[model samples]
Target: MTTTSVRARFLGDGRIDFERATLGPVANGQVRVRVDVCALCGSDKRLLRSGSPVVPGHEIAGTVVDVGADVTVPVGTRGIVYIPVFCGTCRRCAAGRTNQCLHLRELIGWQRDGGFAEHVDVPARCLLPVPDDVPLDTAVLGLDTVGTAAHALRLWQRTQPDGVDRALVIGAGPLGLGVVAVAGAFGVGEVDAFDPHEGRLATAVDLGARAAGDLAAENQYDLVVEVSGAAAARETAQRVVAPGGAVIALGESDEPYTMPATPRWRRTDCYTVRSFYFPTSEVEANWDLLRDHGAALRDRLTVPVTLAELPDAFARFVAGDYFKPCIVSEDAP
Candidate 1:
């Protein structure tokens, strides 16, 4: 069966074009989803600037409407699309580290056609089933916002077995706000956040983080999460972290991550934990986190718009007029 759907295409130099795409039958080992909500991410800016070869909306939540041969996931099952297409047979995958799969090559939005359309075909294994009680919009945050934040904190716990006393988050964007929202639940104490944009920083404060007084202060926070891809933010994270503390690098950048050979940098002894998206093993736990904090986050971060309004939504997103703009399907419940 073939389906025609309206999807967004990114043309280079900050342009978006909407076109009707003819999607062929679901390939074997795949499932076709009717996208209910696809949230804009900061990472999508890179694709918007450079233009993507495939459709580009990664933080996705939808309902499975069609299944390929041999797939057990029933139609009408709600799920969030896991971006990393991991090979299930790999040792890392066998250990439930799907994000760290040894054979990971393509991310759904980056390398393959993603959820900027009404329907998207993805690997059956990449569908994370949503609980019946969770709303699709709230469940979508499990992909990048709350999911990644929780994963980073979980990994940081390994470095500091006791607990995080004071946590600092640089960049109060969607993900940074996510960390702030879940920090207390993760046992982090006295969370503080910084962002150059006052509006975003205020949002972080609304999410339970204190406004950072000074970015220049050193050796203050026990855990510093760097969520902005800016080089300066990375430097700030390295500087503010205490000697025995850990810096969780969750940001992505095209610019090289540099460790300056300053005397302070040379003497400090700290663990730098870099984390990717959450592993499938953590999905159940993440759902709990979402259930506790997801609604507030959705209210603060997401501004829902129709599929036809996607280009305008992205325009506002680029202008910082919207925090996280979501393309919502008309039929979404």
Candidate 2:
């Protein structure tokens, strides 16, 4: 059965165009999702400027409306789209590290058509079931915001098995605020956050982070999470982390990640841990985190908009007027 879907196309240089397209008879191994909500992310800003060949919204929460051959997911099942199109048979996937799948190539919103539309066709395996208690807007955060942040912290725990005494988050954007919200749950003590935007920093404080007073003070924090891909923020993370501490880098930037060859940089001994999106293995645990903190985070970070208002939402998002703008469908339950 074909469905007519309204989707957004990102034309280069901050332009958005909509198209009404004929969607499928459901491709094999894929299921069609009627997008309930799709949250805008900071990474989308780069795509906004440069343009994307595919639909660009990855933080998706929706209902499975149709299924392909061999699929057993019932229609009307609620889920958040998992971006990574992993080869489930790969060695990494077998080990539950699906994010690092050996044959991974496409991410739903990056290489494939995604949920900036009335409906999106995604690999059946990419549909992560959302709990009945969680709203679609909040469930969307379980993808990028909470998922990435939790993965970064879990990786840090591998190096610092004793748990963090004090942690610092650089950049209080959605993901940074996410790190703040879950840090205490991960056994981190005294979470502090630094961001140039007063409003965002205040939101971070409301999420349980103390305002970081000095970004220049060296050797203070046990763990420093760099969620803003700004070069200066990267530098600050390295400077402030105590020796033997870990710096979890979750930020994405077009600019090359570099380390300046200064004396302090040369001498400081610390772990620079970089993590990708969360593995499917962690989804259950993440649900628990979301149940505890998701609604509050969503209330502070999201401004709801209709799909047609996506262009304006992006403008406000770029202007720092919206922390996380979500395109909510009128039919959304």
Judged by lDDT, which candidate is best?
1
lDDT of 2: 0.92
TM-score, structure 1 vs. true = 0.98
- lDDT of the candidates, in the order given: 0.92, 0.92
Residues 1-333 of candidate 1: C-alpha lDDT, one tens digit per residue: 888888889997888898998988999999999999999998898888999999999999999989999899999999999999999999999999999999999999899999999999999999999999899999999989999999999998888877877899999999999999998877798999999999999999988889888778789888999999899999999999999899999899999888879999889999999998999999999999999999999999999999888878888999999999999999899
**TM per prediction:** 0.98, 0.98
User: Per-residue CA lDDT of candidate 2, range 35-146, in tens?
Assistant: 9999998888888999999998999999999999999999999999999999999889999999999999999988998888999999999999988888888999998899
Write down the lDDT that model 1 would get: 0.92
In candidate 2, position 180 carries an lDDT of 95
User: Model 1: how far is 117 from its true place, Å?
Assistant: 0.5
